[model samples]
Target chain A: MGTRQRIVVAGGSLAGHSAVTELVGLVPEAEIVWVTGEPHKTYSKPALSKEFMQARNELAELTLPDVAGDRPRGLRILRGRSCVSLDASGRAVTLDDGERIDFDQLLVATGAAARMPGMLRGVDGVFPLRTLDDAVAIRARLADRPKVAVVGGGLIGCELAASVRAFGLDVTIVERLDTLLDRPFGGALGSYFLDLHRANGVELVMGAMVERVALEEGRVAGVHLADGTEIAAGLVLVGAGSEPCTQWLDGSGLQVGDGVLCDAHLATSSPGIFAAGDVARWTNPIYGLRMRVEHWTNASAQGRAAARNMVALATGRQDLRKAFADVPYFWSDQYGQKIQMVGWHEGHDRVELDRSGDVPGPLARFYRNGRLIAAAGVNAPRVVMRLRRQIEDEARAAEAA
Target chain B: MKIIVDRQRCDGNGVCMGIAPEVFDVDDDLYLHVAETIPEDPELRARVRQSITSCPILALKLVEE
Candidate 1:
């Protein structure tokens, strides 16, 4: 064995892609194996529901530029293959095809899958826009100009609803929650989101549960809500939510909750194993809370941080490992308006609303014990982003204190 | 290094500004303003490259001289 050091990275999305690129640069002497389940190169998933769904971006345009500046000599990329199981003690991962690859260190960034209700499972016109294939299928259906019924008014559902409305198709959003983006915005921008959708000619069905997906001739015909209403939608788009892809690590002796549980350093229970992206629920030092962020920035930043730590552990340079600290941030583009949110707002108590034109748009700041914890705004990139930096500074000061 | 932005595709998320504020700034009008010349600092330049790649809309492009 020529200086045996091997690192295994699973998943092909942004997190895994970023991790592999960093590892390639950091561990020039170690063997790196990347198990990318998707055959295509890494692309931006956020564009799927917006640009790609609206056909504003071509299929080839969504591909992310390669970040692996200088490819390592011992790097191997296994495309179109997935991890089936893992043996933590044995330090090996079994592929879907029963091949076992031993690793000195492992990084799990499998991401998440869109949740589909059982009633919508076999319906032909039902779609979920989590993956590229799903977006392609939904785009194909959109060419038919079918009445769209969007399930859940979360980020994906709201964005897709706006995109579908842009096509002049009748769109009805069925959300169990009363408001749009309540969790992310922390109910601070209460009626702003709702009014935006309404102003865009989107049909909002609030506090309604999708009881079933009406089918005709093995295809989605409409949507049935628990409120005793039947919406005549030719096709149904389910943006219900997502579940982290952790079924493969079921018996791997790793702590797996809603996601792969890890520490602030993103290290899993196993010494050489770590997790990041939507598949990781780790303790965030900023808020002192365990969070599983599906946001793109968290995945991108955490992937790079976890890769450095993994290299340190694999090379026996443990002192070089550092804790990953980040104030989560994400933005949404809907009907020509930009919605941005920064910092964690789960436990915020007081919220201050600012529509006095101090900012470029309607903005709200969340607070706990008079500390700025989170802020959300519409079309206010400069002010909102500045608040993000302030939140990071406050967090740093608090940590030092 | 020179920075170019695709204004047509830029939604002005300010992700680049969050990474390297010295080189990227978005105004109140949600217009992204890139620095005319990026200083030749190795660490800052690396971050600028990361910021370019991190743009949610992929609107930023870097040209090295």
Candidate 2:
């Protein structure tokens, strides 16, 4: 081969780490440098709200084992350092310390960061549950045994409330939505969500806005709702949501939308540049829709797919590059219940909900224009997974047609 | 390669089953069942290894012979 290609991978989380693992196997002669601003790189993020927060998983157990592959000989890792900027045309990456890394190809898997409101910032006993460190800090606060208030009723918020309640502590959820995850099934599962959380002893304030956090001694003492309801909480956790880490690509001449805008092939606007993970909002070929999935499974699979395409480009084998198409799947564990959804549930005109006695749990199938597009099941694995495959076949058939 | 699953930590998330369904399967009871014998296929073997590590809970461990 010609002089070995140099690849710079930004972000050391799941997406970036998974990409490096595959690149090492595909191009052993390539010099790869991975950069991240966090120290506990490669930890399982899903556990942060579940097992880790519940104390079922130890800190050491959160570390992920190296995926089945040989270690890269031409690889270097820079921890606690982040890539602050990128020059897409020049193929240069600037680290936080002002160090510049030149490369032939660049993978922008920088991932996402927590989206916290300004009102919740700089307050003691207020934590955003996004990273391992966030989980650690929350867990340490659990020793004090304070009343908890969770902001948001989305996946992370509900999951966090469930975990905190597992300790038999008092926790309340303040959600702006009328029901939790209404977009998932258009409020079909609203009662089910309320039932599960209420039975688990969680206080839910739906259709409520947080006016402010009442603090005592600069620490959270209570939360004030806009409707004039006050929630007394000693510790407050915000599961609001996350924003993609794309500020570094600002003015870098790369197309940036809610995330790095990519085509179906996961290629960015610039040549020799690609992006994956939560930081990528690409056209999903499976649904013919543009989406950015910030879940564990999508990041893992996208990382591998992007790396494969990057290798095909680096080797000048344009024909070998393949478009990344996937049926997004995510599962949440709350109060010992396994809730899973596979496929996109957006813009479905019709929903076929099955709560029959035959099924293990409530199942809902979403269809757009008479074509099956998504499925969701609670505590049902085999049937749901079967529907997952059926969804792939049907969605792909529809996509082809 | 022999696979060992820590039952306590395994919540049967089916991440492994999603990757290589031929080697791993999760039933409706939220139980993960691994195949008794792994087929002698290189591509399948690599995917099996990925399935092991891809397990979000790190419940699966591989013991090589």
For residues B2-57, write the lDDT of model 2, one tens digit per residue.
Answer: 88999999998988887888988888889889988888898898888778767788
What candidate 1 keeps of the native contacts, as a fraction, is 0.54
List where candidate 1 sits over 4 angstroms from the true fold.
Answer: A67-71, A316-320
| Candidate 1 chain A lowest-lDDT run of ten | A65-74
The most accurate candidate by lDDT is 1
- Each model's fnat? 0.54, 0.71
Clashes of 2: 0
Question: Could you give the CAPRI-style class of model 1?
Answer: medium
Give interface RMSD (Å), model 1: 1.3
* Candidate 2: regions farther than 4 A off: A66-71, A184-186, A317-320
lDDT for each residue of candidate 2 in A1-401, tens digit (9 for 90 to 100):
24879998898888887888888888888998888679765889999999999999897898886533435588888888999999888889999889998999999999999999999988898899888889989999998999999998988899999999999999999999989866644565777889999999998899999989998987899899999999999999998889999999999999998999999989999988999999999999888889999888889889888999999988976855888888888899999999888888888899888998688888889888988888888988888888888888987787677
Per-candidate DockQ values are: 0.69, 0.81
Clashing pairs in 1: none
